[model samples]
Target: MDLNKIHNIYFIGIGGIGMSAIARYFSANGKKVAGYDKVKTPITNSLEELGIRVHFEDGVKHIDLAFLNKEKTIVVYTPAVPSDHQELTYFKNNAYTVLKRSEILGEITKNTFCLGVAGTHGKTTTSAILGHIMEPLKATSFLGGISENYNSNLILGDDKVSVVEADEFDRSFLRLSPNIACITSMDPDHLDIYDKPDALQESFKEFAGKVTDTLIVAEGLPLEGLTYGFGDSAAYQALNIEIKNGGYFFHVKTPTRLIKEIEFYLPGRHNLMNALAAFAIADVYGVSSDVIKKQLASFKGVKRRFSYKVKSEKIVLIDDYAHHPTEIKAVEASVREMYPGKKVLAVFQPHLFSRTRDFIEDFANSLSKFDEVLLLDIYPARELPIKGVTSGWLMEKMTLQNRKLISKVNLSEEVLKSEADVVVMIGAGDIGLMVDDVKFRLEEKFSLLK
Candidate 1:
């Protein structure tokens, strides 16, 4: 559907990170945007601040009358929205042109030169990195996460280029047509939709076919494309890496040239690979290596990707959006590298019962890496709670000696009593709200008493 014919955009799940970014895009593009969310959140408040009308109730009665015009309005619904959602049902019955956010994203980037970042874990950071690189080089981008450098999720630039975090959720990335793309991982996830690991991998294989120019993947990903990594064999590989002032300083040798001493603050080897993917895509887009280097160093990472909520002399508390086992491994690996010999305590809230069931063993193995582990109830996002798939069930499988299944109410108290020097709150749920509280409690007031 042509967007010019539509004047009002109604989002069924507007508080979501992806949906909010799209809402911002529509608002910025001059469409009257309003949405209904099931709850009020910091994101919802921010949307209201941006003049996007957001109502917490799910009832159709609360919808603005302007959204009732089927011809003039477009209703966008997220897959997470319940099938019986009243407003969504109203839109469907009233003949409003309803579309998934992925379809809208497809329409948005169809005509532009899209750089799609697809993966289970690194999509947000890679897309934000590419967005930052492309924006200064005159490319517009819509990122999945808020980039700290620009302090925004939507970056407006000239029409020549666009960057998108091509999510694999519900096969969302299949909607994009990218001139160049990068897939950081092919780890099995979303088994509720995929049913098996091979199915998920097959989806990636198909997604790789959509790139008209080059497809860059991490070194070990199953996809056959121009590769980038720390290993010498990759077409574009990073070498001579050093962490200087908490940022990585590395030299990259691409197939064509050697660029020396590029920098970015996002820690972990995974971020370095993310940087490699972004560098490859931007370089193919005709962005100069010097320009790429400059933007890469200045590019602030995506929120919740590796967000440092609290960092003090004795304690370092990180809040990450890692939900998958692979993602947790990356977080644990990075934290351990940064603070060797310090006890690392991770409080994890499992997201989606289906996912928890799908990867219980892997989750258990990963969480066991931490010295102390606190598990919370599964955040049943988009999925009904499955039998025997609770966080407590998952906790029983963990090999970690120090593990507890605690409620959010008691989580703060549990954390307060812990003796660890490093605390990591890991999840893709509302548990991030506790980060600020945890930080405040662990500030100078709780200095090392030794």
Candidate 2:
């Protein structure tokens, strides 16, 4: 399918972070863009403000007649969409040029100098950093999360170079043809799709083989690649790491020269690894060490990836898109490291029932590390409720006696009344949308108490 011939791009799940980026890309390039989402989010609203039509209903009737032409319009959908989605079924049955979001991204990057970032976690932050590094030279990036620096998930540039998060869900990363790529960590996730851990690893190994240029991996990954980490042996290493100014101050030892005194604004050792991966990829593109160092320090980070909402002395509130056990642990470590001796309360909303059921023990152990835990019902993004799997069930398994299961309706009130010195909201679900409201309510509550 020649993109030049396609006049309109329609997204079935347009409000998704990744999908909305592509929608913006097409709309900017003279393609009439529009689509459907199940709910109205800031993302959907942003798209509407960009002159792209967005409807919340699932009916084909809502699709404009201009997009009904099979030959001139391309229909892009995320794998998260249900098989029975009415608009999706209509496009398939009507012989429209349908493509998955990953497939469209692959087509977009095939000819460009593509820098693909793949991992179970840290992909968004790493890609956002890499995109910022390459932005001076005009590299377009379709990120999984909105960058605080750019204020948008898509960084528009000439088609010469591209940066993207090579997603692992549904084996989507395999479709990308990256000129240079990095695999941050190949942890077993989405077991509901892969069924087993080995199958998940196998998928990553396969994606690694598709890289046309350099392949960078974390120090301990099984695959033989240019490794990046803190240790001495890796090709790109961050040595003498120190936490300063509530951020990381580190140096990168490239295979060529020692880049000294790099300033990173994000917290945690996991983020250090993410920075190293991006630095290695940028190094491969012959970007100067000084330039890489400056770009990194200036990088603000993604919206929900350890984003701080209120950092005042009176109250501290942070939000993160951490749903996995490893990510949750990293968040806990960072919070505890930053505000030691402070009572930390973690408000967690489990994303999917299958994920909660699969990582029951892991989730319980991670959440127990917090001083107090408040859990909301599972978001159930795409799945029906599991028989015995629930947030209440997961909270009961937690060893922490300070845990409470609450509904979204009571979440604001409960959070406002909590005495914890630091509050961190952790989840990949709609819980993120409530962060602003929670912050406002907390401020009001503090004023009343005063």
Candidate 3:
């Protein structure tokens, strides 16, 4: 579809991170933009601040008259939206052009030199780092998460180059045509959609086939590509790693040369690998090693990837979007590494009932590493509860001695009861919305003790 011919773009789920980025892109390009979401959020507020009209209700009357013109308008909806959604159904019944969010992203980046970052995890951080490195090249980046550096998911630039987080949910990444791409991992996730781990692997292989110029994979992944990792066999390897002052200082060996004294601020070995992946992609694109190193050092990070809400010597609080078993283990390792000998409390909200049921034992084992655990009810974003999938059931499977199933209303009280030195709240759902209140109560309680 020729986007130039479309003057008005209406989004059915405008508050989503990916959808809002596309909305901002069209709004910035002088298109008349508006949309409807089921709830108002910070994302919708930001869109409204840009003069884009957004409403919470989902009705035909809520849509502006200008967006009703079928010839000049197109409707974009996310896969998470229900099929019976009123606005989406209205657009379909009226024979208006309706497309999935992934289809529109594919169209937007089709002609550009696209750098797609695909994986079950680490895609957001890797893509954000690559976007920062490519900013001088005038690359427009559509990120899956808000970048702390740019403070927006859409990093505006010229249309010649584009960086995007190629999502694997619903096989969305298959729609993207990338000139250069990287698969950070192929962990078995979204089991509700793929039903088996092998199918997910095959999907990644299919996406690998679509890479026109280059495909980079993490070492040990079952794909043929220039590899990046800490091992000596990788095409791009990070050597002599050192952690000091809560960041990493390392040297890198590229295909052509050795770069010395590369600095990156994000914590965790998983994050170090993310940085290496981005560095390899940019280096292959002909960006100078020195320039990439400089950008990596200056990169802040993506919001909620490991955001520090409150950091002090006496009390520490961290928020992260780690919903998968592997991701939770990575966060646990990072916390143990950062605060050695200190008691750490992990307050976690399981994301989906199917996911929790599929990996119940794995989730229990990962959450057991913390000194204390407070489990919240599963945040069922797109799925209903299974027969026996519940937080209490999962908590019973955990071996951790100091674990309890808690309610959101008593979250702050339960958290304050723990005398742990550090508190980490991990989830992908509305637990993010609860972090601020938790932080405020923590500060107040600590101040009273002082």
Candidate 4:
């Protein structure tokens, strides 16, 4: 289990956001890193640019002999990887030292002063904001998504402070021993693994039990951690919120001192929660109130989380990585707050068959918030297509009279004709790659309309 003694690192299902973060970490630390992914993506491409060898095929024969050694090499596999995966099978049969990405993260940060962020939602944003604050103070961070502020998911630093998204999938966060941690809204998610909300809550409790010092829970999440909210019950609360220049202006009140007029550029009440959690960690570490205020305002945001594709008074396009029902509700509220009385069109691609089946009612209710809605077929990331579970089913349940299911082929055409004041794209799947395409078509169509 001595990571320092191992030199080679190989990853299966490396294209995932979490796995790719680990791949970058090992590669940056001078380990020979390589991985297998079914599809090449912008993430895997970034890893290759960093000199990490990545291949698309599942064939075990392509693995270099040097990386095949079972002793010096450490194999990391994602939970998404199939049981019959070729590289995984080879590694197991050859008696290689194998670990899940979570285990690897636990091992890597166990020696450092770990600041972990765990929850069903807002983990990425909270962790990134914490990382941004700590990075200025010379902290190493492993994030779930690339930070627009730093332009990278892996923040390299020599100091011991390390911020990371302690993931809940496969009970991953339980492996990490954190000095401080935050649990943002713990909605019932990943039902395929937990089967029920209480089971997931139990896991969160178990994970929170390992924090050595501070643990901040979001406004209303059911947990025993130090409460974080916009009210008095929490140790860290945001109050006197104001909206100025299309961003949020709020006060972060910690136990000792309250930092006023902290300007955060990220949207949504959920983002306010994210900032509160990050500020709580920074405040505990003796980071100056001025530093926290500065960092919170200047923090750009994580990619695909309310990322502005195109913005103008005439036409506004917002892209977000919101898959869960609660996240969608947050995004919708933020959109409404930003553009009052404007006709909003929300385009969503449901991710995962299991999720679609489990939260259909919640999804329907949340997505109905928009004035107009368009739903693409379910992405079905890993699971086989489930019977009676499809976008058509979801579309039928929506209360929005303007909503309809559109194929990716006709998506642009449908949007081109819509009379929406603000257009929002929300999903966590490959639907992101279509953002630029949708933007291009909208611009062209808008020009003609003008």
TM-score of every candidate relative to the true structure: 0.97, 0.98, 0.98, 0.97
Clashing pairs in 3: none
* TM value for model 4: 0.97
Model 1 misplacement above 4 A? 447-450
lDDT per residue, candidate 3, 73-111, as tens digits? 999999999899899999999999999999999999999
Clashing pairs in 2: none
By TM-score, who's the top model here?
3
- Work out candidate 1's RMSD over C-alphas: 1.8
Backbone Cα, N, C clashes tallied per candidate = 0, 0, 0, 0
* Model 2: residues with Cα > 4 Å off, grouped in runs: 448-450
- The global C-alpha lDDT for each of the candidates, from Candidate 1 onward, is 0.87, 0.92, 0.94, 0.87
Global local distance difference test of model 3: 0.94
Tell me the tens digit of each residue's lDDT in model 1 across 1-450. 677888999999998888998898889888999998888988889889999999988787888888888778888989989888888887888777899999999998898888899998898998899888887667777888878887777887766678889989899999999989989888888888898659999999899999999888888887788998888799999989999898899898988989998888888888888888999988877889888988998987887888887777777888899999999999999998888899999999999998888888999999999999999899987777788888888888999889998998888788988999899999988888888877777774476333
Query: Between the candidate structures 2 and 3, which one is better when assessed by lDDT?
Result: 3
Candidate closer to the true structure by TM-score (higher is better), 3 or 4 = 3
Point out where model 3 deviates above 4 Å: 448-450
Answer with 1 or 2, whichever has the higher lDDT: 2
